[model samples]
Structure formats: structure tokens, C-alpha cells
Target: MLALLSLPDVALAQQKARTVDDLAKMYDVASCKQCHAKVYEEWEKSTHARSLIGTGRTIGGFQGMIRAGLMGAFTKSGVKDVGDVKVEHLAQCFKCHLPQISDATDEVARELVKAYLDADRATLGKVNVNCLVCHNTKAILHKWQDGEPEKGVVYGSKDGPHPDKYPAMKNSVVMKEAAMCGQCHGTGPNFEFPQPSQCATAYGSYLHAYIPAGGTETCQDCHMKKDGKGHLMPAYRDPDMAKRAVDVDVEARGYKFLLKAGDSIPTAVVTVKITNKAGHRIPDG
Candidate 1:
């Protein structure tokens, strides 16, 4: 499934994070679990919760991209060895995998790629899209218009004082819209890096085909708000959504076939057709 934050266009920040632990200090979801336990538990089951170590495939892909794209001489990324890798080198994959990497030093990038290459799940899984990623860091779409996301503020549907570390809560303008998910759900190749790479095009498909075809549901409508999905935000991984997104039909005919020996042989022809009923492409990759 494409990450809900597959298009986290996090602005570069002054480097502070040097290790996964450092990042956890700012983005850990566990901290919010105290008050938002239900939502936090649901998020724990989501792909966003394990944005970097998703099913172990994310780690393998990161390892492969480093080997083939950075060191393979194909992209000329100026990274010929593992030690040569920097945050900039991993920008293509980290754009979606973990945009918070932008807040870390190059050393963190080197450590991450090495962890991926070494298949270190514990290390790779340490940092991920946490509560702040949505409710704080990425909550506002128009930063200039809405002002920057305040440090102690947790953006949600309505404004109020939070009970936890986040002292304040402000209503987010784009929280219910598709843009919140579509922002990281991918539009096209990430052209911001020297070596551009695309993770998912569902958002582009949603904008072009789904919207033009008069499809009214937003991504949040189907993924977040529907069927009590909440923070789970399932896609194809949810069996019900999979069944609803695709349909298959089968037909078969039995007939007699002519043989060269002037004898008739029984023959069977089977035809199968599959259709997509979802807003975006099925099995988006």
C-alpha cells in the first residue's frame, strides 16, 4: 500500500537528529498514546506507523536503491561507497519513507542506509511518521497563510487545549481533505532530488482520472473516515477494500476440435476479465 505520507514534502531543517533516538525525541507516537490511546493503537497497525520498515520490503528497497542507484554508477549520485552516502543521497527514497530524515545530519543517513543494507529491522524501525508528523509538522498546507505549525500545538479538527505534552490544539484547514494524504501519496516522480524516483502515483491518478470521472470521495473519505478506519487508514491491505476495488468475471466454453487424423477432440476455452472499481489504480506501485 502507498504510505499515507508517501509524499511528505518536509522542508529541510537545521540538522539536529544524529541518530534514530534523537528523532524519536521529536516524533515518537508513544508519547501521544497516553491520551489518544485508541487512535494511537489504530495507527500502530497502519503502514504509516512503520513507514520505514514496512513489511521489511521498505528496508530491502532502501538497500537496493542505495546499491543500484547511488553506488551502481547509473545515476552518478557521487556516492561510490556506503560511507559516501548523505541525507541528500537518500532524499529520493526518504521523500516518502521518512521525510523527517531531512532534520537529521548526513551521519544519520549513512547509518540508515547501512542499517538497511545490514537488514537491521530494530534500527530501521526506530524512526517513523509519528503523531507530530500529521497533527503538527504537516498539518498545515499553507504555512504562509496559516503561519508555521507551532511547537506546542497539536492540529486537529477543532481548537482546544490538549491534555498532554502538546499544550494547545488548533483546527487544521486541510485535515479532512484529500490533499493531506495526497500530499504524500505521490503525484509523479520526485524531481527535487538529483536522482528522481517515484514511490506511488495514486494521487496523480486520483486527480486526473477519478476527479474528472466525477468521483466525489476524497482519499480520507474512503481510507480514513470510512468503516471506523480512523488512524488505521487501510488501503488494499484491508480485504474489504480489496474486494470492493476489483471485480473478476470468468466464462468457459466447451467444443469439439477437428484433429488431423479426422477425429474430433474436446476443447475448452476459458476467458477471464478483471475490472477496477476504485478511484485510483488497483495495486498501485
Candidate 2:
């Protein structure tokens, strides 16, 4: 009992000593890319890479879109001054869109946003999704201490090299589950949209229907396959991928014993069957 009780105290002390930069180093994709060159190269071309920053029609992509939507919501709520819109109010958007920023508390987000507003474009634009955001197996273990991530632990799906150098390295099975992807994909009500909306309904639909129907495949199995290469989650974005997700068949039957010549024309019954071959409902999200 004494040993168990002391554990929390020890953890608290360690957490208090760490800074935001310490946690950032542990989660930095740049550091990770040194060893994971192949994975980094693949991810570089993926939509995930441009989640926070992009160009052309994809400028800032989803992150920019969410920010614009939130700004609109804030405007509607009487926050006429753009400067008055607090980063805390946009926490929900950061949760998934800016996971690195969201990993820390709202105060940290506020500080970062302030720095961003004050700094040059080249400096502020460095913010984006990092490795630990989605790949962290022990995501539940992540917590905030003094407006930064709790120190001494970094999680992933598989064991990594240099565990001795980086004591925070650890593996977890949860990273392999559909629930991991559902963290953002199965989002609920937030500041912008308070009502329950059809966001990423794949996981919910899978639970209620697919699981009971004896389905075992996870979101990764299909979305992270050949065309995606575990990074690009191509759905409607890729024409061929969308077509491959569902199987369709048409059957027709004609009545042999029809009515008289002038009577009602012989009718043919056509049946069209559509099967979801991707483990979730078609057109998810």
C-alpha cells in the first residue's frame, strides 16, 4: 500500500520538473525521421503531412478549414474582434487537427498562438502533426502537467531502437485498435457544432453493425493498405479506392407467362445488391 501510494508522488515530482520543450523533443517527427527514413518519406507525401500546413486548394487543409469554421462561429457569438477569439475556445478543433498543440493544455496553446502571431511566417508555420499524435499506443497515459505533457513516457505500436537513450519509449496494443483512429474520426459535440453530427461514423456504425455481424477487420486493414501505405487514408480522395471499397451486382428476371398482346407489357424484375467490402459503411464521413 505504501509503495503504491508513493508512486503518484514520484510521478508528480518528475512531471513538475519537465518543460514543454522536453516533451516536444520526445514527440518530434524530425527526430523520428532520422531512423524512420522510409516511413517519413511515405508520410511526407500523405494528407497527414499536410494536415496543419499546405498550399493551393489544400492550404492548411483541414486545420485551416476548421479554424475558419470556428472563427465564423465565434463571430456569430458576438466575438467581433478577431483578437478576442481565445485559443481555449478552439480546443476542440486542436484536439485532432493540431494534436501536438492539443497534447498540451489551453494555456500552452494560447502561448503558442501568441508566439505564432508575433513571429514571422517561417517560424510560426513549423507547427504540425507529430509522430506521437496517432502512433502513440499509450495515448491515455498522456496527461498535462503545468500546461505541458507529462514527462518520462513516449508510446508507439512497436518497440523502437535506442530505448536506453530515450527511456520514455514504450509500446502499446491500443495503437493497433480501431478506437485509436476513432479518437478524432468519432468526434462528438464541440464549440462549433454542439449537436451530434455525422462526422466520422465509421467506427460507430462498425460497432453497432459490423462487430455483431462477426466482422474482425480494423480501420487500418483497409485504409492503410497498398494505395495508402499506412499514411494516406484515401477514400473519396482517390477514385479507384472508392470504387474498390464496395462490390455491386445486378440481376434481372423476366416473366415467361405474360398477358395478351395488347395487355400490360411484360415486366422484368431487376435486383441490385451492394455489399460493403471495406469493413465499414460506404461513404463514411
Candidate 3:
């Protein structure tokens, strides 16, 4: 079955017998404030809180797809009426972007994009690919939840800490695995990444002979960093996380004050180039 529970919510889900509806009920972003109130405050200021959900950053990538006439009729339902669709309809985007909300079918996804296009400041701007999309394990792409394996993600402690609200995660090996990042970072048509896009190929570098042998640094180690961002997976283009991962160097390049015809010859050509020396991949799924 398509995975419904995000990792954080999975921790809570263990305490109770969870159904799809139960998962939906418990996956409230508002509920995160119960324990992570301060982190929630930081998250509120961060772009992560608003990203795919149409709040902090522009969801123009997905939106641009629609404007470019990439949208087509759903093969399953044979529904082509784009005029009647709403912004809350896109399940494809919701599947990876908004894990909590249900009924995000292909038709619905089209509707959501359409709705976003037609929406004004009013209507609360239906939650587009909201907070749980990337951070929550539920939104991981091209993977299915294995029922037999102890389901859920745990950030702190091994053998799992007992949570009164939901499920308790026991083994955290999943957190350290590159597969964890591949859960969303890489994409395929259904299970493996089918397309040739950069988003789909993100996990390849981790699997190859380059980088480091047996590198255990998962995406979470760099982006999540146990810094209370939950699962926003911030990196690269991120305005905030980039600052924490960058350093600058300056050295004198044959500087000599020479007065040539009263023209200041004290300055020489100084070149500066920024490189992504530190930091790593972030899961976009």
C-alpha cells in the first residue's frame, strides 16, 4: 500500500493501532507544537515551514509544469475536466509533498495546480505540499512501507524511547542508511527512478565508488543535523543552512602602493570563487 505515515508521526503511531484515517487524524502539523514548540518557532521563521505548501518559497517548479502545458488527462479515471479541479486536488504532489492529506490522486493533483493558478489572497490558499512533505518519512518517493519491519522513524536514542502519544521506534538504522535519503531524494516511475532528471538521479553519487567507502552520513546528518528542523532537509540553495556550512579566505596578492601619475595603483585584480566544499544532498521528495 502507498505509505501514509511520516517518520515522526510513525513514532507516535506505534502506541495505537493506526488505520489510514487514524494516520490522517494524527498527522496534524499543529500537533507538532506539543513537544517541539520552540523548534516549531524556529521552523516558522525558516523557509522549510512554508516551502512546498505555498507559504515560504515559491512552488514555481511544480506550478511551472502546469503553465508549460505538461498536464495531461488521468489514464486511470478518464477525467479531463480541468475547469472543475481545485488546488487541494493534486495527490501526486501531495504524495511526496503533503503526506498528511489523503485523496491526492492524479486528477486531484491537476486540480490543485489549477486551484493555485486561480487562487487570490483569500481562500486560505489551500495547503500546497505543506510542512510534512519532505521532512516526514511518509512522503518518501518510490518506496513502500514494509509492514513486517518495525515501522516509524526515531531521531533520538536506540531501542526507542517510550512515547505516550504514538508508536515508538526501536531500531534507527533506517536513519543512517542512504536508502533513507533515496526514499525521497531519488525518484522512479513507481519504485526506482525512471526519468533522467537530476531529482531522480540524486542517490547515485552515494552508491558509486566515489565520495567515501561505506560513508554512513545520510542526508539527515547534513540537512536535518539534529538541529530541531525536524525533516525540512535544508541544503545547497537554502539561504539559512548555507551560511552554517560556508567559509571564506583572503590573502595578500603582491600588494604594493605605487603612485603612477597620481593614479592609485595600490589595488590588484582579486578573484573570489565560492565552492560547495562542505554540505551534502537533501531529499526533495
Cα lDDT listed for each candidate: 0.81, 0.56, 0.47
Which candidate gets the maximum lDDT versus the true structure? 1
The lowest-lDDT stretch of 10 consecutive residues in candidate 3 is: 189-198
TM for every model, in the order presented, reads 0.89, 0.62, 0.55
Worst lDDT 10-window in candidate 2:
141-150
Candidate 1's C-alpha runs over 4 A off are 1-15, 260-266
Q: Sum up the clashes in candidate 2.
A: 0
Q: Write the per-residue lDDT of candidate 3 for residues 1-285, one digit (tens) a residue.
A: 897889877775464422323433444466556776766666665544443544434455655544542344333333345654433434344444554445323334444555556643232233423334433343233345533332343333265554534345444345456666565455444332221234444566555522466555555666676564555555556666666656555554656576776665566656665544342433333
lDDT of 3: 0.47
Measured on C-alpha atoms, candidate 2 has an lDDT of 0.56
The full ranking of all candidates by lDDT, starting with the best, is 1, 2, 3
lDDT of 2 by residue, 1-285 (tens): 354548876665455313345445545667667777777787777666654443344344333333555445544533333344444554555565566653454344444444434433343345555566664422553334313332445566555554433456556555678786777766334436432233556777777778889988877776776565666566656777767777889999997554777566667899999887766676764
lDDT of 1 at 211: 95
Q: Is candidate 1 or candidate 2 better by lDDT?
A: 1
In the range 1-285, model 1's lDDT, one tens digit per residue, is: 864423333323333687778887767657788877899999888888888888646677777787877889555677888788888887777766787786787888988888888988888778887788888888998977988888889998999988877789899989888888777887888888776776688988999999999999988888877788888988887887888788989999999998877799999999999999888987783
Order the candidate numbers by TM-score, best to worst. Answer: 1, 2, 3
Return whichever of 2 and 3 wins on TM-score.
2
